[model samples]
Target: MIAFFLQGLAIGIVSLIPGVSGMTVAVALGIYRRLIDSTKNFTKHWQSSLDFLLPFWAGVAIGIGLAVRLVAYGLTTFPFPTAMLFIGLLAGSIPLLLKQYWLATVGRKQLDRPLQLLILVISFCVALILALIQLNSPLSGLSMTFPTLWALFSLGVLSSVAFLIPGFSGSLLIMLLGFYALLTTRLMGFMHDILTNSLYIDWNSFFFVITFISGFIIGFIIFSHFVMAVVINYGQLTFASAFGVLLAAPLAIIVCTKALANLQGSISVVLVMSALLFLVVGFMTTYVLGLYSTEFTREHPHQGS
Candidate 1:
């Protein structure tokens, strides 16, 4: 239980990274389906799976609470360096993601050249668009506005649902909704306020959190069901689309890097070195944890579905 909870904390922290998904880690770990199923049938598998999953979810919630603050502070204070680090993280993971897909389904030699080229082109275009969107948009100020809360709640639900779909990126969805930075900042502020006793418990803030979490639960069930149906009935197209998006994501991050307002000083060099180090760490961390999870799955193989 402790191990799984810690694993979830790791997964949650990684999910905060752009171009990455907690689901990717879950999939690599061989428990993606089990986690999805357990949550889907909470009433049925509550005793067996909930004990395992709940702790992990709690860990994830807590981790996200802390991470949101850190990520926000870094981005606001050191935008260029932070962006560079993320670029390293994204670049390192791209090959692993693509190669795994090809090896699992069609070997590299077996792919149709024309179709592959088409996918590559599509991926590039998608990446460019996503990058441009992030770069061009002004950072929205934090707000307690009802409309803003509704948007935040709506985006939270959408991003959460994306988690249930194998290749969908909740972070990307959050980016599109323009609440990625805002949510992180507000949550960070909310927590700091509570910890420092600077402000009373804000009912309005609490209300939105509850609303968003409820929406996330409802959305996850529905979206997971939708994705399952698609995977079962139209897996080829589904995978192709997912592959296209995954391939595009790193490109998106790279393009977004160009959108950065270059900072003063030789700091870019320092950022480059630091980012590389972090990428090595992130890659190796995922690889080792993934191996452990895989071994665990082999020992406790799932029963017939």
Candidate 2:
């Protein structure tokens, strides 16, 4: 339970990065299949599913809550070094991905490696273009109306579809729909407002949350079974595309963050050394976690839990 909670925490924190995939993070932690299984059986086996999922969801909530404040501060205060740290963390997952997929891919000599290469290149370009476009997209302002409500529902539906595929950035898709900016502002705004003594809540914001989540839950359950079918039917190609997106995502992070641009000409030795140090720290952290997760999943599979 503690391990599941920690895995959720890490997923939530890293997932805050633009263009990063929460599903990829879950896969790296060795819990993606268990999560899908839990969700699949939740209706029929509510008790056992709750035992496995409760702590995990709690960690996700807290992780995102803390990351919201901390990332905002770090990005504003120590932009480049902070960005470097996250980039390193994102890059660190590549080794784990390679270890998991590359050998299997190579073993299947009949599979079209050339086609996979094409997918890798194409997906990389697609992710890069989306990130660049989103960096320029207007992200703030929302009004509660019929159209807005419909839009939120549509976003929820699309998010459910995007989230199942590793390396597909559901947040990036949300941004493309023109709601990402206002959605984030409202979330953080509500947090600030709720923290005040009055505990006042805005009905409009509350309604939006309920509507979006409603659509998400509906879509999630309906699509969960189908997604695994797609993955199994098109395993190598699917993962190849996923790897491409994963590779391009770090570059997207750099562009979206403008971390280097935030330096203000203070490119000192201290900054360089500090950036490198943090990068190594992020790398080692994921490397170790990914390493242990492999062994842990084999010895203590989540099925019995």
Candidate 3:
């Protein structure tokens, strides 16, 4: 149980990274197949799975708590540099993601070239539009508003479901959609209020946090089932769509400077130079980590069903 808990903790921590995949983390931890079976057959295996599931999820919850605090601090203190790092992570991981998929599906009729191209274009366009929408709005810019509640709710669903997708960084998708910082900050503040000033808490903040969290919980239960269906039915197209999202994300970030208005710097050269360095750091961080995870999986394969 302790080992399972630690594995869950690791997955939770890596989940915060836009480029790191929870599935990959689980694979590295040597529990990918068990985790999937436990999830997929919870009803039939409830008695057996609880030993793994409970402690794992508990660790995941705590891990998320710790990581969110770290992310919230970085976003609050160094918005531009931090985002650059995230973008770097995204950029670095893309190649690794492609490489793995290529090796796994080579000569396997992965995608119908013409249809794949069409889906890819559509996915890119949609990703860009959503990225721009989130970039210009209440959550992405961290200027939360009641009017954007519905939009935030929609994003809430994506946030909860993103981690479940294989080799895909849901956090990265959420960040590209402009909700990562806002969600983390709001979550941290809500947690702080619950611990420190329960009575004097701001009702508005409370409502915002509660609403978003409620949506997350609901989304998880409802969409977990939905994701499995889609993946089983259209796995290849799903990958294509995710690939498109990944491709458009960095471009979206580059175009959305106003979203980073909170960046503190009067000199463009210094800031740009700093951002470039952070981007490289982010890229290398994910690339190396993904490489290690891949090698680890290859060395010690688990045959869980």
Q: Give the Å error, residue 60, model 1.
A: 0.8
Model 1, residue 188: C-alpha shift (Å):
0.6
**Best-first order by TM-score:** 2, 1, 3
**Whole-model Cα lDDT per candidate?**
0.61, 0.69, 0.67
The runs of at least 3 residues in candidate 2 whose Cα sits more than 4 Å from the true structure, single-residue gaps closed, are 103-109, 169-182, 203-212, 295-305
Shift of residue 285 alpha carbon in model 3, Å:
2.7
lDDT of 2 by residue, 1-305 (tens): 89889888877776665455677678767777777778888999999889878988778767767787776677677878877887777677666555545433442444666888998999888877877775787445668899888888878888877777665666656654555545555666666666774467877777776677677778878888777655545656776787877777676666666676766766788988998998898778766756654622353232210
Q: Which is the winner by TM-score between candidate 1 and candidate 3? A: 1
**Model 1 Cα lDDT, one tens digit per residue, 1-305:** 88778868877776777666677677666667777677767777779877878888887887787677666766666665566555555545554444334433442134455775676567557656766776777355655687866766676678776676555567655654455665565566567667788757766556556666777777776676565555434433444555666666655654443425445445567666765676576566655544444522343232111
Worst 10 residues of 1 by lDDT: 296-305
Q: Which is the leading candidate under TM-score?
A: 2
**Residue-by-residue lDDT tens digits, candidate 3, 22-80:** 76566545576577567667799898789899999889878888888876666666667
Candidate 2 TM-score over all chains jointly: 0.82
lDDT of 1 at 237: 43
- Looking at model 2, residue 263 earns an lDDT score of 62
As a TM-score, model 1 comes out at: 0.78
Q: Score candidate 2 by lDDT.
A: 0.69
